[model samples]
Target chain A: MINKLRMGAAGAVFAAALAGTPAFAADNADATATAEILESIDVTLVSGTSLDFGAMVVTGAGTVSLDASTGNLDCSDADIVCSGATDIAEFSVDTASDGRTLQINLPSSVNLLRAGGTAGNAADELVLDGFNSDAAYDAVNDEYTLVYDASGTNEFAVAGDLTFDGSEGPGVYNGTFNVSVEYN
Target chain B: MIRLAASRLSCFLACLAAAGTFGIALPVSAQGDLLVAPTRVILDGRRGTEVILSNIGSEEATYRIGIELRRMTSEGQLVEVSREEANELEQAAMRMVRYAPRRITLPPGQPQAVRLSARPAVELPDGEYRVHMSFRAIPKPQPVEEQAEQAQGIKIKLIPIYGVTIPVIIRHGRLQATVALSDPGIVTGEKQKWFQLTMQREGESSTYGEIRVMKRGNSEPVYMVRGVAIYPEVGERRVTLPLSSEQAAALKGPVRIEYREMPEAGGALIAALETAIG
Candidate 1:
């Protein structure tokens, strides 16, 4: 079954190449050779989803985390109070080829600073790190890898821990982090 | 036509409701999703190539392209390296490659080509030099509110920036590599079984392909993984191939493990080992 899917993918690439060859053949009466490489990999984020840790109150200095595999939050610290709904960031990946593996790169750490304030103030920032993901982690190299299924489509989620220093001023804090994917 | 429009409207409303459930004050607009084609590039001469970048999200996104250094570990991970940490060959690779339009703003569902070429320096060594090209989406600034809704406490909004990096390799002169498969064994974990091996690579270039494990008489592979790359920096890469419970049961007795190039690349056999597993 897997081999058939791979062959089908190869046939599609060959058909694309043939489609491009007609242009060259039309320009000349004799046989003309041409080659084209078709795109095989695709990745996109699922709509209407984001990595929300929900709302939390920091009494002193503590951390809150959401599990990637299970969407449960670990807010059992004595210095923090957690409430509301939370979610993990979700992404959908599709590859035309079968048996291909993907390397997922998530940032080691990110900083969420107080909104509408001067940038780069350490006192008003929250640090997010220790990202967890649904993909298999290569402990030796500290990386993550996901394999394409027979259907060539896979979904992965990412969650992380957010730490507060208890000195941050009251207000909304916003930040952005990068997630990268590539053929391994 | 009316139904189509109504369905789209429903989707938009559903998305807003999902966002509101998580305390998001603004409507969700799935931004910064991108797709890059021809994931990795290999430049063997002075000839140039192009990589297609598309904005697959609903909103326009700005992507910043830059060249960075990454070194591969024995475990097949690409770790970012600094300029000072980069060796001479890596630095040379970074200096010679050039690309146009470092920053691009792409509308939703639009694709743009980034043209790139390599110009090897004179008297360059006859080995493979590599650098990673990174495309990162820049996040849009948040709109400032005229009035503060909360006089005390705090709220948080976290946006995920999406990006991808492909290895751009420049092979200057004659380059070759040989690989050997050793230490073939199956490790049974609590919930999974893995076929682990050490791929020992020798020479200038990297070895990239697929690993197939098949029973001696079977014509089909019981376990397979494609796009396994062992870069030049790592002499011996540890490859752990995951197997399902049923596949593991069938992998007993005599088995054959073969590492071959990807099917699209002609599937040439790079290394093979015939062994027995209990």
Candidate 2:
């Protein structure tokens, strides 16, 4: 009986050795299979100086222009002009993947914008504050949306800098630039 | 109709440079709005919902609400979502862009319905910008009051007051945006059929604008692909853009996509792809 038990143990050891045969190559085989599947990679822009901002490629991809003066919210009494309509400069990235699939990133860098409106009171004219941008992902379209992120930012210089006197300013008095953007 | 701004107080720039025109002033009685729609909201782009603006004010006002596009490129440059050509291949999502009335006359004490959509473009690009729903109002001028003592008994200070209050809501568009890169770069006067781009301005109540394509990152775009636009109620057809060789040779960088969903809609620009000589 002891000899039979020893034989059984020897057989189990042999089976375990046989199992190791496939285990060693299993990972490699799996990797090969994965390699066969289509792969997609995205190029993220992470504020790197190594990137040459001037070095660019013009993909055949195209986008529509969404420049409209009506998006400016104003009052009927206020003589807000609609003539300052700007043409949209939408950029596209057509990958080898047929441009239909848009890949949005974390902390999407996009926002909805409203620009160039002014208000004035005796003490201080509450200008548009012009810069508090946030970002969100547009899942249906698979893209990132953002707006001007300048609120609470130190770029405006100072209240004197933020303030404008279009009446007396030259070039572009930078009149009360108040605009904000955020993601959904 | 005036396009209202995100901010409550928009300067009534007598000078015509003001792009959007709308106003901010809560209704005397907070009935439909404030209770129904918040002054502002975090609009989700996928649902393609319609934001309804009600005239909850004591008096009716005109409105021209629309979407505005803005963004920084992958290379950290400001994409022009307000250009005639595709400075970038950025698509306009959710066709949720438009004005209530290019010209409207609202009645007092009645809720007027204006819509802003949150629909994604059928062909969308990448890069996000600070996009906001902007509006402006031109409150009708009130008559100057001439204070005169009606009788010897009582005197009332007749201070003439007038206002144009516009309620705004952001409706989403179901349309989506996608990017399509041209073959390297189509030469000037060169005819190349690379791909067919689809467009839809499916907003609740907004005007549909045009689709534009220009080279991305071009400080000054040399070529443009644009034409007459339309206004639709529900499902309008799609339009195509034909590029010329001049457009191909000089169109550098990615193209910015900008368009309106409603007859006069507004939207944030989306980038499609980079373009250059192959």
Candidate 3:
């Protein structure tokens, strides 16, 4: 049954193409080419961007935080020495439909562990939590909402607070976190 | 030309930092760019439908598709519930929904369809069942350069994985719901005034639509919010709509707040209330 439908669709396209030619034998053809268009929703991480908390030296352990809305870093703790450039994670959402409501979900927390260290080793990990975003928060929904603009594009930034308990190993740490978006 | 050179210098510095510390060149854009059509799905009958998943990024990507259970909180949050913790209805819903090609790899600008159908048991009760379908991009392991072993400084590489989930709903039999709007008031916050109300829902199904507030005699709505939903799991949902100073002033007298179905759903009125706001 599927093969027959495929043949019929191919035949319809061929007949339509032939009918467009000046030398076609038939004056007209009633071939049908049905198309089902689906609404498009695209989510992309902005190029050349990452949630960088910058390089910091920890003495007695404190918090280094970046504000998602303002791109401001708060490293005022006396024990932490902060340096280098920091960035908030950014994403762009585009949809074919205008004014569509979307939910942006960010991980509540993520752990950055020392490279080459065993998983689940607390000594080698730094905890990052208190994830915040620039998206409008819906108190009713307890989630963030990103409404597509007139052009169907919405961009938002995400930031979080990194904390070290003063016992974390000093090696290079690597980790991954997830962000999700869904239609509301 | 100067701007181009500046960007190049930054890029070089970034590469130098990576080499001097981690000894690996971080990906410029490692996360997958994904697109999914018809973010929400409804299966009211036996006919199956296909969801199109497209890879819009520059590199090929793999996506793992799976069905998960989520329950709606009174506050309107969808919290993930493990299979062991799901209720009988949720378990049944998960068992009935079927989809093929649990995973797929797509090249840039290419799209693949994941077909889904629901098969309710013979004795299944008449109600609405819902599950969330998640499409997550599996992260690829970065290749470690030889110099990675020689680098001394401790560096951190944070990879952000991107994913999306759409609610899939199946209505087995007759389902209906009624909504009511109540407790209309004004809340003055630090930055702005907010219009607050509670939506009470009853019956077996869920209600989703838009809320519009208008002055007693005006044709235009003074305040409007779209894509509001009250799932069956919750009896009432408190909604706080942000209002401009002018809108707050205009809403001082008698106003009408109406909750209607989404425009695509024919814009039928679900609930309405008339009250004065101060």
Worst 10 residues of 3 chain A by lDDT: A1-10
Candidate 3 versus the native: TM-score? Answer: 0.81
Q: If ranked by TM-score, best first, what sequence of candidates would result?
A: 1, 3, 2
For all candidates in order, the CA lDDT equals 0.73, 0.26, 0.72
Q: In candidate 1, which residue pairs get closer than 3 Å at backbone N, Cα or C atoms, i.e. clash?
A: none
Rank all candidate structures by their lDDT, best first, as comma-separated numbers. Answer: 1, 3, 2
Number of the candidate with higher DockQ, 1 or 2: 1
* Model 3: per-residue Cα lDDT over B5-50, one tens digit each: 1122233223322222321121233458776766778898578776
lDDT of 1 by residue, B51-157 (tens): 66666567899989889998877767778899999899889998999998799998765556688999997888888988898877888877667224463565678
Number of the top-ranking candidate, with DockQ as the measure: 1
Candidate 2 C-alpha lDDT tens digits along B130-161: 24443333334333332221222111111111
Count clashes in each candidate, considering only residues at least 3 apart in sequence or on different chains. Answer: 0, 186, 2
Fnat by candidate, in order: 0.43, 0.00, 0.38
* All candidates: DockQ: 0.27, 0.01, 0.22
TM-score of each: 0.85, 0.24, 0.81
Candidate 3 lDDT over residue span A120-176, tens digit each: 887788888888888876554457767666543378888888887877766667788
Please report the interface RMSD of model 3 to 1 decimal. Answer: 16.9
**Better candidate number, 1 or 3, judged by lDDT:** 1
Interface-residue RMSD per candidate? 12.7, 30.2, 16.9
lDDT-better candidate, 2 vs 3: 3
Question: Which lDDT tens digits does candidate 2 get at residues A1-184?
Answer: 0001000110111000111122233322322111111111111111211100111111122111121112222212221112222221111111111211211222222221111223343122212222211122222233332221212111111110021222211111112121111211
